[model samples]
Target: MRLKETEPEEIKLNMTAMIDIVFQLLVFFIMTFKVVAMEGDFNIRMPLASQNQEESMDEDFPTIIYVQLAAGTNGNINSIIVDDDTTFSDTDMYSKLTQLVESKIAAEGNPEDSKETEVEFDIARELKYSYTVKAIEAVSGKVVDGQIKKLIQKIKFKDSTSF
Candidate 1:
């Protein structure tokens, strides 16, 4: 019996199409990428609750100013109230808020008071987000002679459902 010998054929995969697909995917992802701006810089410090009630009720405790942002029917800021007394509903609400915050800081009679002061924002659920941000900016700080003068460093948000 006679046997026939056969040679094995080399198998070559066409990688050009695979490389093209990889480049296309890279280009698509690059084109669809988006850049977003940075968020606001806020410094907040919350200490643990005191076990002693007397210490919590101390007279030297840090001052907490409440800011109430009431919204109108149109979701616009109707009034900006500070401590349930001072209210600003004029067109320049933000400026008034900034001034009030600044005055409060100055009234402490010490430059170090700004760090100890805290602002609690009680914003209406219907208020526009922009208005809330403006109010925050007003109390956060102000630009003085091209320099930023930091005001109250601590900020907190109250329960909206309570309003």
Candidate 2:
């Protein structure tokens, strides 16, 4: 008998299948995955309308301002915030926001423009929903909804916070 060779055969891994799976998984995630913000304390119980409608409606518009409302420790809406720190209330709130809106319109250099941008509100979740609506209505003569068409001409209910 011939002398036996002790060398072992080399093993190889087929990466093409693994690479194809990885690429497939990547594409699958790209199609299925979505990125969204987490509104931890901020929440709203938006009611679902029973009326079935087309999905393409209200798809192109962009909102302007964002208003955040939270319940103060005293159980009253002691402050109204913008973005985060821009807080105001009473006359101050009205004046500041009004000025901000006015300035925004002015920035476009349109003196006779009646179009209003959106004002998203993050209000105290515990407060009666009417209270929040009333606050904005008191200012814009309407409630914030998509397009701000009714009372709030350019408003959107951004979110609400429990605290």
Candidate 3:
């Protein structure tokens, strides 16, 4: 007896479900993505190390203002010190700092001469990043009524052992 010829069945994968799942995942990720605002947008001019230190020091050397941030045990700023002579609490930081910068500029004979001054933030390693930003903003100056007054344009950061 002769056996009947048999034909093989073709198996095919249904990719529609897989493609749909992939598209769903892409949409989920895209929808869940977050956009964060940038921190510290102030334009501060930093000193370059390539220039001759002696030459700059001779005549046009920028006046240095030291700002020290003392951190408390809770990681917040406990005290703010300017030039190591005056200390201010956090509540009065902005006003006092602005006053100090304004007074310094006034003493220079011309408010425009304040650009020749440099603010050095000698921050403690243990301090929080917020404190540093606060210190920078303090000396960055503010707008009064309608005029935009800039206190110091140049800024520097230094390491300090104490808080």
Q: Identify the leading candidate in terms of lDDT.
A: 1
| lDDT tens digits, residue span 67-109, model 1 | 9999998998899999999999999989999999888888988
lDDT of 2 at 116: 37
Report residue 44 deviation for candidate 2 (angstroms). Answer: 17
The candidate 1 region of ten consecutive residues with least summed lDDT is 44-53
Report, for every candidate in turn, its global Cα lDDT versus the true structure: 0.83, 0.56, 0.78
What shift in Å separates residue 53 of candidate 3 from its native position after superposition? 2.2
**Model 2's lDDT to the true fold?**
0.56
lDDT of 3 by residue, 6-108 (tens): 8988999999999999999999999999999876577755445544354466776678888888888868888888899999985877678889988988888
TM-score of each candidate?
A: 0.66, 0.44, 0.67
- Which stretches of model 1 miss by more than 4 angstroms? 1-30, 33-35, 43-59, 159-163
Model 2, 29: alpha-carbon shift in Å? 72
Query: Model 1 reaches what TM-score against the true structure?
Result: 0.66
Pairs that clash in candidate 3: 70-163
- Cα lDDT for residue 64, model 3? 84
